[model samples]
Each structure stands twice: as structure tokens, then as C-alpha cells.
Target: MEETISLQDLFKTLKKRLALILTCMILGVTIAGVVSYLLMTPTYQSSTQILVNQTQQEQDQFTSQEIQTNLQLINTYNVIIKSPAILDLVIERLTLDMTPGQLTQHITVASEQDSQVVNVTVKDPDPHRAADIANTTAEVFEEEIPKLMNVDNVNILSPAIVGDNPQPVDPNPPLNMAIGAVIGLMIGVGIAFLLEYLDTSIKGERDVEEILDLPILGLISPIPESDVNLDNVVRTRRKRR
Candidate 1:
């Protein structure tokens, strides 16, 4: 037989498992908060920007063609910035204790659409090291592009600097807790429904009628012990009289 649940049944299930759902939510948020604030390592970010443009000797005035070419070159520049040729020099200059591949993973190169400026961002556990990596990568790219591409078009637009108080960018506790809470809620509701489906014991007259498919014919109420004792005393008095 197919069983159908109505809205009232759903409400009843939720009410019955309300404590379980709340506990799961609390556990989820607590775990997320702990992991974000204590277990995970916080990463700090720093970025430097470089501009790609023709030198004064190469071009006296900027043309539409020159601007378009520089914009297209930004894509190639982004890849070259993260390549080992650039990262190797950056690692050597900054004395970073990591391979070119490892260093490459931490660096991100991007530019706005149709813009000649490229941003090189780096993330690290140490704020000073992150700033150093960003600046060193930009400087190395600027110095080496002339040799690699045969053009001195790259120029440092802004160097990354460590502020008086740097903040870590990763391990956002509030965001993590919010995500954890959502996941917890989903799991809790699922478990609540599952438990409701598994429970089959009859608890009331409606459950008995549903299981047996028959109408109740009669009702037999149990006599209370006090009422039975009073009846027995009245019978004894009548017998004595």
C-alpha cells in the first residue's frame, strides 16, 4: 500500500524531532567556528599592479592599435607572471623556502577587461612574506620582460606594502559558521524525516484503525482500584445487614 503524509504529519514529525534538529544546528555552528578560528591556518593577501605600455622611444603617441595590442598582451602576461621563469627569480630574491611550483600556486595574476594594468596577488601565512612576494614578482617580471619579449613595455604601477596592522583574509569564522549551519539544517531535516518513516509502532486509536482497516465496535473502560474497593465495601455492608 502507498502511504501519503499530509502537512499535519510533517508538522508532527518536526515537532517530535525539534530537539534533535536544534542540537545538530548547534553542533554544526560550533564545529565550524572552532575550525575557522583555531584549527585552520589564516592566510594573508598582498597584491601589486604593473602597467603594460609602449615606452616613449618606441612610440611618441598612443594609437588605438597600440592600445588594443597591449590589452591583448595582458592575457599572455598573466601566464608568464606565474611561470617558473618569473617565480624562480622571485623565490631567490625573497628567500622563500618553496619550489617554483609551490610558489606558483600562491600567486594569482589578473587584469580588468580592456585594461593595460595587471594585478599580481599573493597569499601566505605571513603578511610580510606575502607583500614581499607580490612586490618581488612584479619587479622580476618588469626587469625580465625586456629580455624575454624584446620589449620594455612592462612598468611597475604600484608596489605592495605591509600596513601598520595587516589582516588575514582566509578562515572567515562567520561565513564558515553560516555555511555549516545551512548544511546542518539540511542533514537534520533529512534525519528527522528518516526517523519518522522508520517509526511504525501504533500509539493511538487512529493508528489501530489504520493498521487493521476496521471500525472500533465497542469500548471497555478499566475500573479504577478506588472505585472497585468502594463497591466491595458496599457489598459487605449489604451482606452484614
Candidate 2:
């Protein structure tokens, strides 16, 4: 026969295994906290902004075809900024120990839609190194773009500055711990229900009756000492006769 469990039964099951669930949750969260603190590496990020304009004048060049041409080339410039040709020079200028590809991996170039501004970001383990990389990459790109593209269109709008106290970007402890706790709780609940489902031992008289499908004739209580002695004497007399 198919058996269906109700909400009450489910609650009862969880209540019965609440201790196990709580233990698992605590252990899982503790492990997660410790691992997050010990095994995770911290990363720092620095960013600089560059403006892509044909001339240094502050006037709006909205109607100029040259401005539109520069806008179209912004995408190409964004790609070139992360290429080996540019990053290689930046690496040599800075005397960095990393390869061109490695430097490229740490750099990001982004530009807004219909805007002439470009944002460059660099991430590293050291805050100062991150800032230096951002600044140098922008500088090299500014110096090299004129010769390569025949247009001095890139301008360093802002350079990356390190504050008195820089913040780490990766290994966010609170967020990691929260996610770990949630995952642990889910696993704990799943394990609790799984154990309950696998348990098939009879726990009560109702279970026995249901399994046997027989009438329970009677249930007797223990006899008193006097009644037991009287029954023994009667049995002895019957044996002698």
C-alpha cells in the first residue's frame, strides 16, 4: 500500500531529529568560517578613468563627424588597451615580474554608452601594486595610442589613488559565512528527513497491531503474592489427586 505523510508527521520527524540537525548545522558553519579565514586569498582593486576626445577643448563636439569617428573607435581602443603590445610595454616600464597575459588578466577596460569616458580597473593582492598598475597602464595607453592609431584621442581623466586605508575586494567573510550557513542548514534538514525515512523499526503497539492484523485478546496485570500462593497450593492439590 502507498503511504502518505502529513504535515504533522513531518514536524514530528524533524522534532525527533532536531538534535542531529542542530549539531550538523553548528559543525558545518564552524568549518565554513575557519576555511574562509584560512584558505581564502584577499584581493585589492584600483581604477582610473580616461576620456576619449579628439581635442583638449571643453566644448561639446556633438555635431563633429570626427567625434563620432572617435566614439566608434572607442571599442577598438578598449580591446587594444588589454593587448600584449600595450601591456608588454607597461610591464617593462614598471619592471613587473608578471607576463603580458598576466598583466592583461588583472586589467579591465570599460566605456559607457554614447559617452567619451573610459574606466580602467586593476586588481591585485597588494593595494599599492594595484594602484601603480592602473596608473601605469593608463599612462602607457595614453602615450602609445597617438603613434598606433594616429589620433591623440585618449586622456587620463583620473588616476588611481590609494587612501590611508585601502579595502580588500575578495574573500568577503560575512557574505561567505551567510551562504555557508544556509547551505549547511539545507544539508542538515535533508539528512534528518533521509534518516527518518530509512528508519523502519516498530516503535509502538499500534505498529505491531497494524503489521499483524490480529485482535488483541486481553492485557493482564501482575498478580498479588497472596493470589500467587493460593494458585500454587490449588495446583499442588490437583497434582496429588
Candidate 3:
């Protein structure tokens, strides 16, 4: 026969192992906070925007096809922005020690759907360096695209600038601690249930019935030592009488 657990049993188990669960949660949160604040390196991000638009010859309004063409070209620009053709020049201009591949890892190119503006973002340990890389990448791409595509449509819309006190984008301690707390809670509950399942020793009348599969005819409570001694003295006095 399969045995089923009820809500009472579950609550009892939780109460029995409450201290262990709390200890695990506190430990997990502390570890996460320590790692986020001290051990992990923080990363800062900076971004620059570039616009893609075709030059008109007769000062006429742009047609729908011309605007759509520019939007399509933005995708190609996104790829070129991260390629060695642009990154190599960016590294040389900025005097960065990293290679094109390493620089590529730091760069992200994205544009809104049906929008002509491209956003180039770079992340680094230093906020100023991140801004410099973002701006230099945009400048290099602006200078090199005309030569590569035989068109002068790319324009720097907004350059990246670092503030007096820029904050790092990564290593959020509170979020990490929250996640750690959740994981620790799960682990603690799992351990509690596991220990309950592994325990087979009997503790009370209910356990005795469950183990022996028999009903108790009567309960015999053991007498304390003081009560037994008093009973023996009373029996001796009766015998002397």
C-alpha cells in the first residue's frame, strides 16, 4: 500500500527543520551579496547613435521606396560596424591593446525596426574607455562606409559621453541575492523532505501503530523513580502492620 502525507505532516516537518532552512537562506544571501559586491568585476556600458539617410539631388521629399531602402541598408551597416574593417581602425585610432576579435566582443549593433537610426553600444571595465570605444567605432564606421559602399549616407547622430559618476551596468547585488534566496529555499525544502523520508525510527503511539500494523489494547505509562520508591515504602509499612 502507498502511504500519503497530509498538510499536518508537512507543517510538522517544516517546523522541525525550520532552523536549517533559515540558516541555508541566510548563507545563500550572504554568499551572493559578497560575490556581487567584492569578487565579480563590474562592467560599464556606453552607446552612440548613427543615422542612415540618402542624400537628395533636387531637394525633393524622400519617396517611400527610398526610405525603405535606407532602412534595409541599416542591417548591412550593423554588420560592418562590428567587422574588422571598422574595428581595426577603431582600435588603431584609440590605441587599444586588444585585437579585432576581442574588440568585436565588446561591441553591440542594433537598430529599431523600420527606423533609420543605429545604436552602437560598447561595454568595458572603464566607463570612459567604453565611451571612447563607442564614439570611435561610430566615427570609423562613418569614415569607412562611403568608401566601402560608394555612398555617403551614414551620419553620426549622437556621440557617447561619460558623466562625472557613471554607474556599472553589471553585478546587481540585490537581484543576485534574491535569486540566491529562492534557490536556497528550494534546496532547504528538498533536504527537509529527504530527511523525513529517510527517517524510520518510531517516536510516538501513532508511529508504533504505523510500524507494527496493530491497534494498541492499552497504554502503560512508566512510573518515575520517586513514585516507585514511595510505593515500595508504603508496601513495607503495610507488611510491618
Best by lDDT: 3
- Which stretches of candidate 1 lie above 4 Å from their native place? 55-68, 215-241
The C-alpha RMSD of each candidate to the native structure, in angstroms, is: 3.7, 6.0, 3.3
Model 1, position 37, has a per-residue lDDT of 94
Alpha carbon deviation, residue 43, candidate 2 (Å): 0.7
Q: Which ten residues in a row have the lowest lDDT in candidate 1?
A: 53-62
Write one digit per residue (lDDT tens) for candidate 1, span 1-241: 3467899989999999999998888889999999999999999999999988755457667799877777677888899999999999988887878999999889889996767789999999999999999999999998999899888888999999999988999989999999999888888989999998888999777777778988888767889999999999999999999
lDDT of 2 by residue, 66-113 (tens): 666667688888998999888999899889999998888889899977
Return the lDDT, model 2, position 31.
Answer: 78
Best model per TM-score: 3
Off by over 4 Å in 3: 55-68, 220-241
Ten residues in a row with the worst lDDT in model 3? 53-62
Write down the lDDT that model 3 would get: 0.90
lDDT scores for all predictions? 0.89, 0.85, 0.90
TM-score of each model, paired residue for residue = 0.85, 0.79, 0.86
lDDT (tens digit, per residue) of candidate 3 on 170-191: 9889999999898888888889
